[model samples]
Target: MYKDLDEFITEYQHTADFWYDVGCVMASEKLSKFGSEDWQELSSIVHNRPLEWQKKLAYCLDTSCNMYELEILLSLLNTEDEELFEICIDTLRSFTTQESKQMILDNPSILNRVNDLLPKAGIVSKKMLEDFLKKLNA
Candidate 1:
């Protein structure tokens, strides 16, 4: 694994597989040292990377992500790529706290889009989808 954060930053930051590798590492490690700067770096990678890379990173984030990272995951909902959008939505399902729910409902359009897209994605259970919709409508 990564020896330390600085080493990871210096050596992997500009590599072609940065996001993919970082995502895997994040999913597997607590990496609690990550602060706003690290989140920004990860977010930047997710925002700037190719669709395939984005999908891989989204999957990794889905496996394990914190509240601070929710916005990055939410931003991915805007993608037109179906696979990426589905992976993003699946990742988003993990953030079920009141704050996360409210943050999502704050963007009515994105919430509505989630309502529209969930069925097409066909990844979430019917009950879970219903609960999410109820929370959004509430």
Candidate 2:
């Protein structure tokens, strides 16, 4: 749809009510696909950009969050970047059980990635993730 992730961001990242829709479509088209130009390029945007973009990128993970992406998302809590950490927790906190189950089923082999993170996560991060996993079990 656009030349690169930045171009897509320029085109779609905005205050419109449709940003989530844009994010959902982008996740389906790009974030879920490993090694595609858009996929490979996402980490740079998340780290190098300002808070808005990072927060918006987190929104993209709101749906169809694969294990590969989830690993990175979970890793954000280990960062000193408060903005990144809060958005990371917020994103995980917002997930419903249906979404959690679907994500686990879709990426069953990587379920341990989430489990393994529990013990190493920071106190707040661990608490949030624990509540999250409980929903997964429910």
Reference-based lDDT, each prediction = 0.62, 0.58
**How many pairs of residues collide in each model?**
0, 0
Q: Mark the regions of model 2 whose C-alpha exceeds 4 Å error after superposition.
A: 1-3, 33-40, 62-64, 78-86, 93-133, 136-138
Q: Distance from true position, residue 121, model 2, in Å?
A: 20
Model 1 TM: 0.64
Off by over 4 Å in 1: 1-27, 30-33, 62-65, 118-138
Poorest 10 consecutive residues by lDDT, candidate 1: 1-10
lDDT of 1 by residue, 1-138 (tens): 213533443334445466555645654453456666777767666666667656655655643357656777788878888778766666676777788878887878776766676666544544556665775455
Q: How well is each residue in 93-134 modelled by candidate 2, as lDDT tens digits?
A: 555557556654465433455576678888977787687667
Give lDDT: candidate 2, residue 128: 71
